[model samples]
Target: MAEISQVSLGDAIYDRVCQDLVEGKLRPNEKVTIRGLAERLGTSSTPVRDAVQRLLRDEALIQRSMRDVRVPVLTEAQYLEIASIRRELEGFAAGRAAEMVGPKEVRRLKKIVERNEAAAVAGRWPQAVKYNQEFHFALVEAAEMPILLAILSGLWLRMGPLIAGYYAREQLGLVRHHQAIIAACENRDPAAAAAEMRADIDDAKEGIIRYIQSFTIDE
Candidate 1:
């Protein structure tokens, strides 16, 4: 019983840590320690260590040394590759979600969108990023495509930190793609949803690739 409980705790910790990564709560290249995680989570070091190992395997956290780990910082080339993949996969998810969306799902997503818009308007970049992530994940989950969701989660694990770091304040005043997606879903229009989702990804990608090239890419 005790062994089972320990394993459950480790799994829980792993999921919690993954959520932080996927939601951009942990910034790019931020160092983290098992001891710090254990203390923050109010648990012992053992489970935190176990969870850290799994995250290391996932490449979400780079192993700096035997005692040091930090969130991985993606290169420009890597970011572009992932952005292309996200456009295809996430667009499909939105299309399927449109086919399945009901009043309840629409309400939930609208609430997340509202929070994201509010945060962006308030210049709370980190909070806005998290809510943006929440809205995307919720839309995907509504698609009922577990395999696609898993793949997207893995991609987001690597990409989230970069996004969190790169959300420009200037872009907040631009037209939001989420509102178009919601309109498509409310009408159960798969084609429109797919187009809107792809547009959203492309919109972010154009700015993000520029940001990466200007700041991080080598000539």
Candidate 2:
């Protein structure tokens, strides 16, 4: 077996926990016990606690008590609100990236988008989730705007559970959305890029809202 490389314990624990949450292994509204989580991750309670605290702050996990946490359920309204903000922010980032993107960054973004599309087609939900995130973050990083990146980072965390739901349900054509956005980037058209970004996010928001509404009506 290959040895696991050592890294920052808190970050390591957080990434693992977040992956589980996004991949539906750690389900929404399910309780998370720090000691149990730590044991499962093959780490100590300290790092797990830190990771839980961060997740709580991110609203990915809600603090139910002093030592207890649960994955927060996504509401329809909250999903729409988060998606709206994310679209605006991501559109701004995309426009900025279009204006400032160099050949190297454009190539990088293309690769990320291509990988995301492949994952979506292959039904590799986790890889799709990872690559979609990488594509957006790569665009923001290309702009060299730390403040914008920070804002988008907060929004992404809030959207994580909802995005996980989208992947699991598999309702929309994510690959097509990504392909359009990549085409805009390739053309170096800021307005076109922003428009594509907004469309992609809006489509996702609609799909999630419709899904949630069906459940609500059923209830």
Candidate 3:
């Protein structure tokens, strides 16, 4: 029982840290220390260390020296590589979701889109980013492909910091490709839904790639 409790605590720590990464609260290349994290989380160091080890094994956090760990700063090439995979997998998920979507799911997704648009209009970048993540994950979840969703979650963990930076710099367009996706889903057109999903990812990739290139050139 105690062993199970400890494992649960470690998992809790891991999840909290991952949520920070997903929400862009953790920046790229930011240093992380087990003691510091434990302090911040108001817990003991054991669970924090366990969680950090898990992240290190997942390549979400890289160990530097004996006590140093940091988030990876992905290069432009790396980012594009991941984005390419996302285009394929995420598009497939959207296609599957099109077949599975019901009126309730459609309305749920529409609400998410509306919330995202409202956040963007209010110039609330963080809220926009949160809603955007919610929207994508919701679509993938509707597909009911657990393995695919797990893969996409890992991809998002790596991309979240970069995405936050991107939305911070650019204005959120009101008529995003999400509308097209919603329409396709409403019409029960799988191919069109997939195409729109791919297009949406490609559009974001282009902008993010440009941003990465400029940063690299500056460096």
Candidate 4:
């Protein structure tokens, strides 16, 4: 029982760190020390070390030297690659969701979308990011494809920080793509849903890529 409790605690630490990463509390290329994390989390170093090791293994954090661990700063090529893959996989998931979604699920997703828009419009970027993730996951979950959902989760875990950073700097637009996706799902149009999902991803991809490129030019 004691051992189980310790494992659970370690897992909890891991989850908290992951959530921080997803929320952009931990930025790309930011240094992370086990001791620092342990102190910040108010826990022993053991679990914090274990959690850092897990994130390292997952490629969410990269080991720079013998002692330096930092969040990964994705190159433009890498970001574009991931975005292309997401366009295909996530688009497919949206299509499947459109076919399977019921009125109740549609209502739930609509509420999430509305909340996300409201948060974005109000300049509550963190809340908007949270709602955006919720909206995407809700749609994917409706597809009832566990394998696809798992893949999407992994992708989001890697991309979430970047998305949060992008949205934090930019003002919220209409998010017409999201509304289009919802409408397509309501109409039971799988192709239209998939196309809208792809467009949404493409738009974000272009914006983030441009931002990164400009930063590079400035440097």
**C-alpha root-mean-square deviation, each candidate:** 2.8, 4.9, 2.4, 2.4
The model with the greater TM-score, 2 or 4, is 4
For model 3, the local distance difference test gives 0.85
- Write candidate 2's Cα lDDT for 131-180 as tens digits: 77777778889878899887876666666656766666763455566676
**lDDT digits (tens) for residues 79-153 of candidate 3:** 989999999999999999999999999999999999988888889988888888888899999988889988888
- TM-scores of the candidates are 0.89, 0.81, 0.90, 0.90
How far does residue 202 in candidate 1 sit from its true spot (Å)?
1.3
Q: What TM-score does model 3 achieve against the real structure?
A: 0.90
Residue-wise lDDT of candidate 4 within 55-124, one digit each (tens)? 9998999897879898877889989988899899989989999999999998999898889889888888
lDDT of candidate 1 over 119-216, digit per residue (tens): 88888878888888888889999999889888999999998877877774334532278888999999989999999888888777766776555554
Pairs that collide in candidate 4 are none
Query: RMSD of candidate 1 to the true fold?
Result: 2.8
Clashes of 3: 0
